[model samples]
Target: MEKSLIKPFIAKRVAQEFTDGMVVNLGIGLPVLCTSFLPEGIHVTVHSELGIVGQGPAPDEANADPMHIVDAGGSPSSIVAGGAFTDSAESFGLIRGGHVDAVVLGGLEVDQEGGLANWIIPGKRMPGMGGAMDLLVGAKKVIVAMEHTAKGNPKILKKCRLPYTAINCVNMIVTEMGVMDVTPEGIVLREYNPEFTVEQIQAATEAELIISPDLKPMA
Candidate 1:
């Protein structure tokens, strides 16, 4: 697939995991794109750590509210009808209180033990580990949505080198190359992109993968 098509492909696959009436939190970056690919007839209440609930998609510049409503990433966003806004305290309360069903997060690295490292790279100036720790442990499910590699370096590793955001917290992973579930046995390959064979996908991953008996094409 063309490089330009990868993110959306991963996003579409992540969106498929959501079901009706689920309250989901979308972390900054790639995870936010899942909103654009949600399947029809499935409605999910999107939560932003910035305090917006029932958040909608990015709006056309001309249609955007002059008040500057934005998501947790600070991107201008729209709120669906019946959506309500709350203070950040209340938002964190909801998350820490386990009101969220699932959270989709972007990762820099994920290891065999379901560890994630995304907040920062050592010595690289970063804002902070915004709400990731809370969501990782608070949400019912944690899904990491990211690319298979970074500049040709594998992001899925035998053990994450960077600082972990949460240990043993990830449940599923969706990348342009494949879909995997982090299991006690190991990383299990569930669906793979037909563009790459099983061997090719394994070559791009540093962690060992257990091929699922029901493995099929990603799309």
Candidate 2:
């Protein structure tokens, strides 16, 4: 698949993990795209650390209320009916208090043991670790959604090279190349992109993968 199509493909697959009435939080960038691909008839109440709950979709740029409604990334967004805006403290309380069902976060690297390192790269200036640390531990399920590789370098590895945001916190990983479950034995390849062979996928990942007997094509 073309590079341009990868993010959305990964997002669509991640969206499949959400069920109706789930309260999900999406990290900035790629993770936020999952909102655009949720399965039909599913009603997920999206949360934004920026203090919005029941978050809706991005609005038409021409009609967007930029100053009043925006996601954590500062992109214009809409709020669903009955959605309420809260103070930052209360918003974070919802996360730290474990009120969230799941959180989809973008990652720089994920390891076989489900370690996640996404907050920063060594010596690179970063604002700080945002809500990731809290969400990873507080949410019921944690999903890492990212590209399979970065400039042809595997982002999935035997062990994460960067500082971890949380250890053994990830439940699943969704990338354009496949869907993997981080399990006790290893990273299990539960679904794969039909365009690539198992060897090809393995070559793109530094972590050893255990192919599932029930492995199926990633749609």
Give the per-residue lDDT digits (tens) of candidate 1, residues 137-211.
889999999889999999999999998889999999999899999999999999999999999999999999999
Q: List ranges where model 1 is wrong by over 4 Å.
A: 61-68
Model 2: pairs clashing at backbone N, Cα or C within 3 Å:
none
Instruction: Please provide, for model 2 over 150-211, each residue's C-alpha lDDT reduced to its tens digit, 9 standing for 90 to 100.
Output: 99999999999999999999999999899999999999999999999999999999999999
Q: Give the clashing residue pairs of candidate 1, or none.
A: none
Model 2 regions more than 4 Å off: 60-67
| Model 1 residue 137 lDDT score | 82
Error of 1 at 13 (Å): 0.7
Tally clashes: model 1: 0
Assess every candidate by TM-score: 0.93, 0.93
